[model samples]
Target chain A: GAGVSQSPRYKVAKRGQDVALRCDPISGHVSLFWYQQALGQGPEFLTYFQNEAQLDKSGLPSDRFFAERPEGSVSTLKIQRTQQEDSAVYLCASSLSPPHMYMNTEAFFGQGTRLTVV
Target chain B: SQQGEEDPQALSIQEGENATMNCSYKTSINNLQWYRQNSGRGLVHLILIRSNEREKHSGRLRVTLDTSKKSSSLLITASRAADTASYFCATDVEAYKYIFGTGTRLKVLA
Candidate 1:
């Protein structure tokens, strides 16, 4: 794809329903990131991936949030037992640099998936 | 937790006037970047400044970094109404991870 792509631009799930959000990064980008943005706030880091490796997930709010990038090119963020607090925009970004580099490069962001848990 | 916090949560300026926003982070960082987002849109990368560098310029945008204070600022010169958007500063605290600030909402009135 020309830029990062996310599926199901908007989602509304009932409480306790499981949801999956997909991200397809630009071809061959080595680093991928997922962020959660609440209304009237900035995007918060959730998890990071280097190639297919899940390197950092310190920001995932709770055990209910999970993300995976099995092929290094595409990623998925899944939320289990959704709660009203889970309503927010989920963003995905990808960069060309790996961890070893200074990572001075910029990452392209997807339009994001807005999840509304009711 | 968010690594950075921005000041002047909301700003309104006349078109053609310069607009500036600041960001301060808590931890050491490799680089700082600014991004713009319109309503219901994805972030658009503006500028990236490496820690070793004091400042950087890209077209109408100027970014400065002060690692000592863990702060950065973005200046948009001769702003246009089209510049109306939210601006966020993201810090690379560690490898492959970026922590974003609360963001500054800039409204450039025409």
Candidate 2:
């Protein structure tokens, strides 16, 4: 794909329901990131991946929020027992280089999946 | 907590006018980037200024960084209705982690 792609542009789930969001980053991109954007707020870092390695999960809000990139290509973010506060846009971004490089590389973003927990 | 803070949460301007937004951060940074978002979906990278660079230009967009002050500003010249969107400034404090500001909502009226 020419850009990062996310599946199910919108999802509405009942409170306590589990939901999964997927992201397919640009081919061979070494770095991928997941962020959550609340209404009227900027994107908040959720997790990061360097290939299949989940290098950072510190941003994940709670134990219910989990992300994985097992094969280093496609990634999934799963939220267990969703709450109303969990309603927000989930964004995915991929960069050509890793953060350690300190390179001014551009990060391509996907048209985020909007999750609405009812 | 977000490291960066953008000023003027929202601005409305007529087309052809210039739009300027400012961002301030708390700590040292490796680089600062500007991004634009439309309809509150994806964000498009606009420009980036490294810690060593003071200014950068991309077509009609001009970005300036003041590492000493820990601040950056973005200037969009001759804006259009299509330019109406949310503008955010992100600071890279460490490898791969980008701390983003709340953002400025720009509305360029035609």
Per-candidate alpha-carbon RMSD to the true structure: 1.2, 1.0
Q: Please state the Cα-based DockQ of model 2 relative to the true two-chain complex.
A: 0.78
Listed per prediction, chain B TM-scores read 0.97, 0.97
TM-score, each model? 0.96, 0.98
Binned by DockQ into CAPRI classes (incorrect, acceptable, medium, high), candidate 2 is medium
- lDDT agreement of model 1 with the native: 0.91
Candidate 2 lDDT, A30-96, residue by residue in tens: 8999999999999999999999999999999999999999999999999999999999999999998
lDDT tens digits by residue: candidate 2, B1-110: 76588988999999999999999999898888999999856999999888889999999999999998999999999999999999999987677889999999999999
What interface RMSD does each of the candidate structures achieve?
1.5, 1.4
Stretches off by above 4 angstroms in model 2 are: none
The sequence of per-residue lDDT tens digits that candidate 1 reaches over residues B1-110 is 75589988999999999998999999998878899999999999998888899999999999999999889999999999999999999987776678889999999999
Clashing residue pairs in candidate 1 (N, C-alpha, C atoms within 3 angstroms): none
Top of the candidates by lDDT? 2
Each candidate's DockQ? 0.78, 0.78
**Root-mean-square deviation of Cα positions for candidate 2 versus the true structure, in angstroms:** 1.0
